[model samples]
Target: MNIGKTLFAQVMEFVPWKTFGRIIERHQGDAGVRTLGCADVFRVLAFAQLTWRESLRDIEACLAANQTKLFHMGIKAVPARSTLADALTQRDWRIYHALAQRLIARARALYAQEPSDLGLDATVYALDSTTIDLCLSLFDWAPFRSTKAAIKLHTLLDLRGAIPAFIHISDGKLHDVNVLDVLPVEAGAFYVMDRGYVDFARLYALHQAGAFFITRAKKGMDARRVYSAATDRSTGVICDQSIRFNGFYASRDYPEHLRRIRFKDPESGRTLIFLTNNTSLPALTIAALYKSRWQVELFFKWIKQHLRIKRFLGTSENAVKTQIWCAIATYVLIAIIKQELHLDASLYTCLQILSVSVFEKTQLSCALQPDRTQPELVSIANQLNLFEI
Candidate 1:
């Protein structure tokens, strides 16, 4: 019998530790560090995310339980609770952020060949934000309200594989629309967002950058129909027209003709008013593009439920950012593993199986494979006879 490393150790094989070490050196992440290094820090936090460990004590205990396997997992030593806590407080979080971006690029390349679900050949992305609430007493640095504190995770998710193409972490006070101003827009890409990001100025900026945007029109939006476009009611499209904003500020902000489509969702029976800058696509296609925005929401829900970002182990801002970035890195690593192995299992299922089996010796692919060798039942005897009744 082959006695191998834990399943968590197997997953860590996908991480480019040497490249990460180089990044740490470049950023001076481990300057004068005696016991705990940057790689060890990330490993501990990443272990917490994968195993759903709640506190520093939990992480220490788990690692201590598996102390003999630490070296196999690329951790030179099992760090104490205080040592790990100090590393989280002081280590440069940018190292993990850079690592996450690098992994994201790889994941994007792998999924780029996938056909768009919306049937469009262009690049499609869903833009949204999820606010993580924090306790104001412990986290006074992140001020959201008078009594509560929080941070917003602004993300741009590629619709192809539901992979995050971009992520921006900001204090909770930042508005969702403002996040658009800092995003580096790719020309010819279609960005689908909710009504919360319906700022004509930002949308116009996106248009000026040669990108298209799809968002829900606000309830009190004032617009004048410039041209009535043809539409089909069979697909739930009520009206398709080219319109210009009528409000003084709105007109000044976005002086271009915006395409408007009113549609009734066949699934929800709710009318949706869609606003977009691209006038070429079919009216039904525009509505479908907006519907794809829900993928980002699902991404948020999945991470929060599976990863340990919601209930933080540390109260410091640095620790919070470190954990969140590590969580994202773990997510990207899983994505890479899934794509590289071409596994058919859902990401949640893969995570759940890997959490406890990290110490198993089975190959990841073999473990994830469906059991197809089960013997088929030859025949079953009828327990109930209709004639007997």
Candidate 2:
């Protein structure tokens, strides 16, 4: 099978560079490099991922080989490494953040259309964060521990499509709860989070906003008696009591009507508690939903392992954010192609095809072409007899 001419070329065609070009053009201002518009920067960013270019010099070399593709992506001229680096450092960070938000919105819309096909419910979103370790001495102000220097990437992923709906980056020392404020939680959406994000006030706000959440509660929390003893069938734990606040609780910043569930983890055999405003579902259902929170961990593994996020070329926070966003953007692009081509392949398999097809001198567009009708993905799956039901 001619992998290069089929899969790789097809994937490249799916990148929505036209939409990105428009976003960049609309946001470019009197930021000095007006000639170097958003499209140029975006093209450089996409190419960096597509080629696995180490630095600006490497980007220039890749562009030199395919100047036409750059032009197609809206670059008037290729800027030097130093010039690009200066622009990235001095240019307004808001512009890039806004672009990321736009891309995220687009991804959300695309995923929302066919949730069932992607194995997701409308309300389920997986929330988690991963640490991107860095060189502590250089990025000293960013903070670091004795053994590892890192930054945290907190993401709200729409599990239906494995697309990131909200993302934020912070110093490694920042608590996970601190990043919760920026998440985009729609009314009636179900948010699944781990113990690190166990904040009463935030969960309260979510409840007040008419949103539902399922999270593992901290071990030791104080609550008054509303119900004497109710057995939680899932973990076989008896609920001690439920409480309602007369006024707002300052410690948790919770409103008057928050419901707390006290339970235990069956697998770990440890006492586990959960706090939620959702009363419609039984406690067992809530426990089951929280168990599915492991999907976000799988996402972290997918990106770090498949996309090669561990080998970062930039040490600056902005540079790191840019790289991570690019990787996500690439993942989204491949997902779109997989759906469009009607390929019943797992995302990991698609990513492997993408990695080799793009970086191994094989074009992404060709590899993903429908007309070729190779069915390499199905053949491999059938040979392994991978379970797809």
Candidate 3:
């Protein structure tokens, strides 16, 4: 009988440890270490995320339980809760942040060839944010309101392969629209956002930078129509028109003509008013681009459910940021593995499989293979609603 490294070790093989070292050196992450080094800290945190460990004590208990295999897993010693807590609250979170960016670049390169069904070959992105609530007593500094504390995760997700191109962590008190000022706008790319991000000045900045934006129009928006374009009502497009802002600030912020479309959802029967800077694309295509914005919402839901972002390991700001960044890294690592191995299973399914088999001694790809011995029939009823009472 032959025993090998655990699935967790195999999965971590994709990380560029050498480049990771340069980031650590730049941050002085491991200026001095006696027992628990930065790598060990990362291994523990990544393990906690992958296995759904809820608290610091839970992580310590699990690592202690597997103490004999700690060296094999590249851990020098099992850290006590206090030691791990100190590391989480003191270590520079930029190491993991830079690492996540590196992984995002690799994932983007791998997904560069992915086809976009939105009828264009340009880079399309969805901008959105999710609020993670925290206990006011435990995290007083994150003050969302007089009674509540929380943090906001602003993410810009590329539609291709549902990959995150940018991520920013901010206080809950900060408005979503403010994130636009910091965004590195790429020329000729289209950004799809919700109504919460409507700021004429920022939108004008994007326009001046040669980028495009699509967002829902705010209620009572003052605009004067210049020309009306023909639209196909059969495709739910009510009307399309070229218009310019009439309000003093609105006009001064954006001096260019904008396009507005009135659309009605055939299924929901809900009417939607869309605003954009691009005038050439078909009305339906603009509507379709906005519809893709929901992908970022799905991505948020996925990470919150599968990863350990809700139940934090520590209460300090640095600890919270570090854990969240590690969670992002783990997510990107899985994406890289899925693409590199060409696994046919969905990402959620792959995460579920790896969760239970983290310690299994087998190649990650081999472990992910379809079982030939038992050909279980997938119920067609799940795919189709056979009957509704």
- Candidates' C-alpha lDDT: 0.88, 0.66, 0.89
For candidate 1, write residues 219-247 as lDDT tens digits.
98999999997778888999999999889
Expressed as tens digits, the lDDT of each residue in 1-389 for candidate 3 is 12488788887788889999999898889887666667677888888988889998998898898888777677778899989988988888888899999999999999889888975889999999999998999999898988889999999999998889999999899999999999989999999999999999999999999999999999999999999998779999998999999999999988989999999989899999999999889988998999989999999999999999998888989989999999998888888898999988778877888877787788788787656587778877557565855
Per-residue C-alpha lDDT of model 2 across residues 1-389, encoded as one tens digit per residue: 34433343445455565665565566653245655555456556766665556677777786677665444444667777776776665555455566666666766676677635324354687888998777777666568587667888898888777888787878789888887787776998889888788777877777778788877655445555576546746665547445664434534477455556666776787666766677766666666677778888988887777674676645676666666666677677667666666667767766655544443444444444425456665345436545756
> After TM-score superposition, what is the CA distance of residue 364 in candidate 1 from its true location, in Å?
1.9
Which TM-score value belongs to model 3? 0.94
TM-scores of the candidates in the order shown: 0.94, 0.76, 0.94
| Best lDDT among the predictions, by candidate number | 3
Runs in model 2 lying further than 4 Å from the true structure: 1-19, 29-31, 34-37, 55-80, 91-93, 113-122, 145-149, 228-241, 245-252, 255-257, 262-271, 359-366, 369-389
Q: Model 1 misses residue 26 by how many Å?
A: 2.2
**Residue ranges of candidate 1 with Cα displaced over 4 Å:** 1-3, 370-372, 376-389
Which 10-residue window of candidate 3 scores lowest in summed lDDT?
Answer: 380-389
Candidate 1 TM-score versus the reference: 0.94
lDDT for 3 (candidate 1): 44
